[model samples]
Target chain A: MLGYIIRRVVAAILVVIISSMFVFAIFFLGPTNAAAVICNQNGRCTQERQALLEHSLGLDQNVVPAYGEFAKGVFVGRTISTGPGAHYDCSAPCLGISYVTKEEVTELLKDKYPATLSVALVGGVVYLFLGCTLGILAAKWRGTTTDKLLVGSSLIVSSIPYYLVALLAWLFLVNEFNLFPKTGYFPITDDPVKWASGLLLPWLVLGVANSPQYARFGRGSMVETMSEDFIRTASAKGLPRNKVLFKHGLRAAIVPIITIFGLDLAALLAGTVFTEKIFDIDGIGKWGLEAIPVDLPVIAATVLVGAVLVVAANLIVDILYSFLDPRVRLA
Target chain B: MTEVLHAREPQPEALPTSDSDPFLVVENLTVQFPTHDGLVQAVSDLTYCVGLGQTLGIVGESGSGKSVSSMAVLGLHDEKRTRMTGSIRIAGKEVVGASDQAMRRIRGKEAAMIFQDPLTALHPFYTIGAQIVEAYRLHNHVNKKTAKQRAVEMLDLVGIPQPDRRVDDYPHQFSGGCGNAR
Candidate 1:
């Protein structure tokens, strides 16, 4: 088991490295000029000024060597300059200085990540629990009016696009009706109540928008599990109805649900662009979205972080599969 | 019209005791299921009885209600989906329309079923010991450790080799014959 985990971890690291390189190459070596964008932002970009900015930012070098410098900056601190006498000491693990803000990309990510994590974790839990419970209940009353109602409602909700739902929720709930508190990111340490109230709308919108898919997945998995012979065996063993449904049936049914959940949560953690944008939360998703066509380093950092999260979530799910099903031997 | 099937006659010498009363009696039991297509009469007017210490062999072609009637004996059919009629008395307790609570007391305590296909009948995710422990713990007020010990003992009693080690193995890990023994 230990050997299997070690191998997975090594493979995950390689995947992250390759994906980071891809992110770097795409943005830095693409048609868009990183130095020119920064120069044009400051003032009219003369040829001399663009060349000076490119040389200072190390964009003038060959792609491989420039990428090497960027990768090295992630491990050890590097000196960054916007123009002459504008040198900034970016600490170790620096992603790069943002073209617009001139702030270290790592520092900006650190500031934005908490909001994204908070929204993702709370909303993820709410949806997972609500969705699975609804699905299980539907499965228990399979072929009944109640089951039809639950399944139909989930389908109706999922049919509508997610962004529209979030937008309508924000417009009515916060703006017109004045039902929920105005949405924004607030540090929990400063004021816990404000933090929760500020985030409550986004959390609910996310949960409501995303839960229908999970409900469908859960219902499908549970219906299949209910037909397994072991379920009959459990019933014959005189286990109480609830125990047989949840312990024996759900224990197996939840394995597939968890696999989907891991990936979904990983995506959310990477960034919830629509939720953050609609709700006005200053999360990584909003930051990354805003960085497009402006801040190349910020975009690269977000993509790199997202790639790492997805790979890590996949590894975690595989490990969890072994624990959930004894038949799944890691070796 | 439903046709009655004959039960194989038991040898007099094979009787454990000369008691005349049958332990299980089913009279005019019918099992039907309502589906999208139509009503499925899985079993109709099934009458049979088996005495204590006597073996009853039910033989028929596929889809001949053999398994359906047996499942009916334990009231295993879904209450909402299935329609059952007549009387099924196990050890003198009527099971045809018994409440779930009453059936729960009888099942796994007074009577238990060994399914035909052991491979799928045993849960794939749980170890053999855990499945046995679940069945044992349902009726008995024993802790998990004690129930697990009994499971190992039961495995050994069934002539399974390395009962202690193999008890922790999943159903798929066991061979066909071993799974059947479990």
Candidate 2:
């Protein structure tokens, strides 16, 4: 057990290391050019100004030294920069400062987390339930009109780009029917009801758009699980149809259903830029777009936030397997 | 479905409490499943009885309808694709074709079951204590605190000693002989 745990933990650490390396490489590749471009843009060109920008962002230093300093801030919890906006620390355990904001990445991320979490969470719930229900219905009504209609509808919906669908939903539902808020966020603490209502519109739209995959997967899983001997045993036991379906069949089919949940959350959150933009929602995806160009601190912070969200979602999926089925252990 | 159950030596205590009080009786059970090819009669005219307190060991090769017969007793399959006609009584209550509300009242409370694989059946995202409490609370009207305590008790009962210290540990911590020793 200890060996297994160590191995798994090591693997997770390696994944994080690799991902962080990728982020570092991408950011480093452009820093020098990026500084030159930004510093010189809309101003009288001067070597002194460009030098100032390079020095401020550490573009003047070698990549290894800058990485070392970044590593120190991340590990030692010590601030490297101590200036006006530069007071934002790049201490240990910290990702770093944004080239634009000169603020600590963590602070910027903290402000945006709720929005990302909200969109992803609501979208996940909506898509999962709708997709599973439709899938089960389609499977149950196979060869019937309902089944055919659903399959056709699912195919059509699945083919449409999510961004396009979000726009259409915005045009039809928000603009015409006024069935939902145009878009924007309402903090739960400020007004829970409004926050809930604000989230409802996106959830419905995202759910409708995202449900096709769920329907397909759910139907497949249900069909497979239904054939399992245990399901038959449950039905034969004279357990009512509901118990047979929910308890036995649903339980058995859950692994596959949940397998997609983490990915779905990540995708929905990432996709929310379009959804939020269409609805005028003030979520992180939209925030990312709005903050870019002028606010580098917010950009890196937002990316870190997204990375954290994705990682957390993955962790959640891993733990869910054991509860869904005892057959699986941490190993 | 675990296929490993038959290998387990039958325990004297696992036997039904008595023949008089048949815990479950499945009679003349037939399940017909419609497929693309045609309808397949999975289980035909199957009959069995499990008395209270007895774990009636079911042994069969794949497709022998052993598990199907059990599912029939529980009514845990979809009705559209599968056709079932049978009489199943649990504690003198008829369940074959029973309503969902009725079955919901019985499962986990009147009759609780454990799956073969611990990892899949259990959600790894949550601590084992949470899921156990959920199973306990689904049938009972207990507060979260009480339910969690009961979960710990069950964990200890299930051979997890020092439940207090071990309860907070995630499933990963106890995967192999961590608490399995208890």
Candidate 3:
């Protein structure tokens, strides 16, 4: 198990490095010239001003050394300058300063992370709990009217585009009904109630929007598990109805669900762009969206962050399988 | 209707609890499944009885109702899907329309079934001992340790060597025959 974990962690790091390189290459190839953009900031860009901007931004250097510096910045801090007179200190794991705001990109990420994590975590909890319960109930009822109703409703919900569902939720629940406080973000440490109230609609919108897919996944898994001979054996063992259904049936069914769950949570944690943008939460998703076309460093940082999260989620899910199914040896 | 079949005659026997009575009785039992096409008669007017000390072997080709009839006795059929009628009594408890609660009480305690294929019958993720322990725990209100001990004991009874050591091994770890014993 220890060896397996070490190998997976190493592999995950390699994956993140490759993805970061891809992000950097894509930004380099992009049509918008970083040097020109910066020089253009001070009115019309003269040839001398563009050259100076290129040298200051390290754009004049070869791509290899520039990438090397970017990589090194993650381990130790690096200084970034827009011009000879304007130098900025970007702390260790420097993602460079924003083109607009002189603040460190990492600092921006730090500020926004709590909101995204809050939404993702709360939304995750709500969806998993609600989806699993509804799926189990539907599986129990099987071909009955209740099962049909649950499955049909889930299908209908999933058929609609997720963005529309989130938009409608915000429009009605927050705007029209005023059932919730205006959707935005507040630090929980400042005021827990306001923080929750502010995010409540986004959480619900994200949770409900994602739940139908989970419900369908859960139902399919459970329905297959229900017919397994062990379930019959469990029933024949005279276990109470609930025990047979939950302990034996659902326990087995939950392994696949956990796989999807880890990935989904990791994706959301990286950012739910639509959910954050629509709800006006100042999160990494919205920040990443706004940074594109102008800020390559922030975009690259978000890409690397997302890749790390996905790889970490994969590792966690693999470890979970060893517990969920004893037959799966870690090696 | 496809084949001219000889329907077995109903055996007149006493209940199994008493000395002269049979342990189990199934009289004129019919099992059918309704599909998109039509009602498929899986078992028609089956009649049989097993005495307390006797073993009944049901032999037939595939698609035969041998497994189906046994499942009916256990009341293990998909209750909402399959159609079962006539009589199936085990220790004087009628299985045909027994309440789910009653069936739950009777199953595994008063009677247990050894399925033909243990590979599909046993849960693959659980160890043989864990599966046995689960079965024991379901019937007995004992804690995990006691149930585990009983599981080892039961495995030993079934002639499995080193029950203590093998108890933690998963189903695939066992040979085909030993897996069946589990």
TM-score of each: 0.92, 0.64, 0.92
Q: Residue A220: error of model 1 in Å? A: 1.0
Tens digits of per-residue lDDT for model 3, A1-331: 9999999999999999999888987886668888887778879889998898778877788777888888888889887785778887776888877766667889899999999999999999899988888888899888889999999999998889989998888898888998888999999999999999999888887778788888888989999999898888888877788888888898889999999999999999999899999999999999999888778888888888899999999999999988888778898
**Candidate 1 Cα errors over 4 Å, as ranges:** B1-20
For every candidate, the chain B TM-score is 0.85, 0.77, 0.86
For candidate 2, give fnat to 2 decimals.
0.05
Worst 10 residues of 3 chain B by lDDT: B2-11
* lDDT by residue for model 3 (B11-32), tens: 2342345555466889889988
- Using lDDT, rank the candidates from best to worst: 1, 3, 2
Residues forming the 10-long window of minimal summed lDDT in candidate 2 chain B: B4-13
Worst 10 residues of 2 chain A by lDDT: A229-238
lDDT of 3 at B53: 79
Calculate DockQ per candidate and list them.
0.68, 0.07, 0.61
What ranking of all candidate models by TM-score puts the best one first? 3, 1, 2
lDDT (C-alpha, whole model) for all candidates: 0.87, 0.68, 0.84
Q: For model 2, how does the per-residue alpha-carbon lDDT over B1-182 read when each residue is reduced to its tens digit?
A: 13222212222222334447577887777777889898888998888888766778889899998766766566565545567775666776676666666666667666655544453444344466765665667667899999888877877787887887677665556765443321
Q: Which predicted model would earn the best DockQ?
A: 1
